[model samples]
Target: MTPSHRSDLLTDALLHYSKKVERKQITLLPQRLAKAAKVKEEARAEFTALLQSVPGTTITAVRGWGEDLVNSLEKTSISLSWEEAYVENLHQLELGRTQLEAPRGGAQVLEVVKRTERARRQVDILERRHRVRQRWSLTTTDSERYLTAAMEKRAQAVLDSVSNLAFERKFMCGLMAKYAEGQTIAKKLSRQIHKLNSKIRRNVKLYNLKRPVIPSSSTLPTLMTFEIAMNPESGLWSQHSVSHDAAFQLKQRLFVLLSLHDRASEEMNIIKRPVCRVRED
Candidate 1:
């Protein structure tokens, strides 16, 4: 949808929900503390809800994504240690406009407000730092799941197949090279050996399969292998959430299989073939 269309829909939804639109471009969120990142967001929402439950209190999240907070605030403000920033934002509240609005016994009430705000900002600083790759503490939770022994077995099966195929390719290629080398050595010995060298070359050309690079996610293997001209399709070769690096690792096993076959053939030549074997037909 166009941005204008999306804006209209959002405006309608907010209005339908009895939400007031804020005039300020910059918004500050009340601070939150929670264990997981998901829980952090939930805690921030809960904090805001708790504030809103009071008749006169208001709490809000910062405008836009987490980066928006970093962008709206001055660099020096963010650069301060979390404790320092909390203390500073609180100081601003106590000494700034909020303090002037305070009635009798406002200083005591203001202190409470300041403490909450300061605590909240500490959480925000940690969240903001994590949002940017400024530091990389966050991680994906894909691997942590309920035991799926059956799925694991299937994955192993596919992996084994892929491994065998990969080994076969590499082994065959090496074997072809060896045979070509032997043919070259043999052709130097006799004119009759020239045909054997030619035969090996033909076999090498026919047997060496160049597997096309298809995306792990591509439904049709041939689609990604073909390059597009201008404005190449992006995400075409991107990894499918389903298909993974395991498949690629499996694909490499073909090489070893080919190598084993060549080894067997070499042994047959060394032990099975007799030196006196000559035929006149």
Candidate 2:
């Protein structure tokens, strides 16, 4: 082939590649975004489950706060999606309006042909008047102009809504991150409480600690110790609803019960030591 012919071939190849790339982007961008959204939704669901599975008695206040934040995040995501749809529909309407024209005379060529011709004429007039680009389309009526302006305003509003939703999502994420440490502590403490309760259930009854006669009428003091174990009154415990203080309080209560058991058993050696003591450095 001649050099000029090769250059023409290269130019055609470049155009074909550019078109292919454009089509690929159009096809992939939405799919990629959808996959990302799905992943985000799954992550949020998992986070929600984590918050839910956290023992309520453990992190009563913190759990409530986390759940509220998750709900707010979900609402923001939903609102953002709705606004995106609205913007897309309005853009389609704007494009459709530009592509449509008024009906023309009934002739042998048909109404469609007449309308096409009329649209072409309108475009020519608009191009001469406004020096528009090639492939430009216009609507030259007062109503159409007003509708276009309204669509533009609606688009702007949608943009603002999107911005607000984004900020809300960021804020919710930040709050969740900030509270993560507290949740972790709550989760760990809750597990420890569960284990301790099991241990106390097995061991507390073994000792002749004053068994609440009429077990139906009276709560097992040992069982009730679990309530004090949660220790909702203490600042740290109330703040997180689960903490070291709650666990320590439970241990203290258990020790007192055991000490009484030791006294009753005539195990004076066991009673010689302090029931439960915290060492100071």
Question: How far off is model 1, as Cα RMSD?
Answer: 38.0
How accurate locally, in lDDT, is each candidate? Answer: 0.35, 0.41
Q: What's each prediction's TM-score?
A: 0.17, 0.20
lDDT by residue for model 1 over 1-281, one digit each (tens)? 99999999999998866433221111211111112233434445554554344454322222122233233222221134433343333334344445445564767766756665764565467557646333222122221111122223223333223323333333344445544555864344334333433433443232222112222332322321212201112242232223324343222222223333445445445432222121110
Instruction: Give the 10-residue window scoring lowest on summed lDDT in candidate 1.
Output: 25-34
- How accurate locally is residue 137 in candidate 2, as Cα lDDT from 0 to 100? 29
By TM-score, how accurate is candidate 2? 0.20
Tell me, by lDDT, which candidate is best: 2
Question: Judged by TM-score, which candidate is best?
Answer: 2
Q: Where in model 1 is the C-alpha error above 4 Å?
A: 1-147, 181-281
Q: 262 in model 2: Cα distance from truth in Å?
A: 56
lDDT tens per residue, model 2, 192-250 = 54554554343323322323211333222222332332333523224322322434333
